[model samples]
Target: MECERKYRSRALYKACMRAFDTLPVCALVDSRFLCMHGGLSPNIRIISDIEKLDRFVETPDSGPLCDLLWSDPSENFDDIDDQQPEFKPNNVRGCAHFFSYYACRDFLLRNNLVSIIRGHEVQKNGVRFFRKSSRTKFPVLISLFSAPNYCDTYNNIAAILKIDDHQQLSVVNIEAHAHPFVLPNFENGFQFGERFVLYHVTNLLLSIFNMYSPEELAAEDGRHDKTGVELLNKKRLIGTMDRAYAELKKINKITLNLRGLTPSYSAYKELLTRPEIKALVNEAEKGRITSFDQAIQLDHIFERRPHT
Candidate 1:
């Protein structure tokens, strides 16, 4: 009612939708880092395979599209073995195979790439790096989560990685603010345990953003604020989607452990059916918005000049 009255044809809404039509699922930076939300898939042999995909359409139920949008890094020891294939069914989220160290190495070597920088997991420290192996000389996979104090409970800091023309990397951690209202109007509906699980699940699925730390990243390059913050916004859309998928994997683990609270697979299945969850997935598919409140908070965080 309000939308139609505010704009007879919903011009603002339509304009935003069209803006989303131009986005790609992933991007390559200086041909060094494979920047994607989720981890690699068995079906995706080459990066160009992504370009071959038809864009601006509803993501199909299964295929490289679903895997790219939904997969996560495999933590299972059996799957991470270098001698064995790094691909295994991801029982956690129930879609997209879990990728191991060997799998990531193959992808990078085949694609002639360096690191796979993905933002799909909530690290207690804001950012996490998974090396090729305990014996590897350098890190090959970087998992970045830019939401500080995740869900107003995790107390986690948020960070962003900056790679300059020279291919140097730096992570800037944002201090989590005190947000009393985590999910507005949504928490009051469920029971205690249900709400507890739901909040964490929602937190896992929603990826709030952070202000960039050019100074933090500039220690190596000495290039200060030359690249305006506008460039950072471009990465936020894809990064947030990646983080949301990673968080979903976390929710699955949490529910599995708290089986008394949630009915394992049934609990996750129920979660998928949630109207709130559905709206989130839809927006992620559209790549439009993450969270209205968090969006405003991010604007405020960046708008204020950072204190030196």
Candidate 2:
């Protein structure tokens, strides 16, 4: 049973990876601005260069795809006024080069791009604008990072960039909301699935129900409960499956963060050896129980139990 579960998990991971192939490497807006997740690469000299690359496979470690996903801007290299091409190795990140202003300018001119907007590194102010040089008037590059109070450590402000009809750029900073000091156990797969995953599962159910006409749904009212959602019509179920797939396509990535230190490999390995966790996972899977509602009811029952 364990082996079967592991095999299924591996298959699901592969399917998720293949889905990434359909995502665009970069998006051009209004034929003037280029938007991407990371900075420029030496191989990607022109905008057309990105169009030529195959995005069907996983990003290579030392190629254009890797550079686009991993690169960061270097403040140290921007001190000089000379427009000579330069490259700075980012020993901190251990991947992708730290690009210079001259490099940004060359890429912009070559591609006829007005600005390059990217998000890779976090900023305290949530946004940073980089010009071609200290004397330059217009911004050649913009960096944005919107998750404030990142990792529950930094007291940073998040910002949103908005462009008006006249092409004027503006930013709105958002204050971070207070969260519990002892955050939810995001590391626990079972608990995480119960909290976040099940919410989406319920949405999938409702999105399925959204397909049927009110008249059709009302016809089964006598058979269904007062909520009128008990009866599972085959046609509606099929429509739900199609809609669920469409919803899956809309997701790009999921980022998980550990609030503090991660457990050592030996400690984590020891955790897997525990029999109770295994039993819990096995029982949960076998029952097809991914419902948060069930967990809430169990919690309420536990609360009502008399203390020893």
Measured by lDDT, the strongest candidate is 2
Q: Tell me the tens digit of each residue's lDDT in model 2 across 23-120.
A: 99899987878988888887788888898988898666567887787777776544665654556654545666678878887787777778888987
Error of 2 at 123 (Å): 0.5
C-alpha lDDT of all candidate models, in order = 0.60, 0.61
Global Cα lDDT for candidate 2: 0.61
lDDT for residue 120 in candidate 1, whole number 0-100: 61
**Which portions of model 2 miss their true places by more than 4 Å?**
1-12, 83-85, 132-136, 179-308
Predicted candidate 1 versus true structure: per-residue lDDT over 71-153, tens digit per residue: 77777533434566577765655656678877777788888888788876667788887765343455678888898855443
Count backbone clashes in candidate 2. 0
lDDT, candidate 2, at 70: 73
RMSD of each: 24.7, 20.3
- Residue 57 in candidate 2, Cα distance off native in Å: 1.6
Model 1 clash pairs are none
Pairs in clash, predicted candidate 2: none
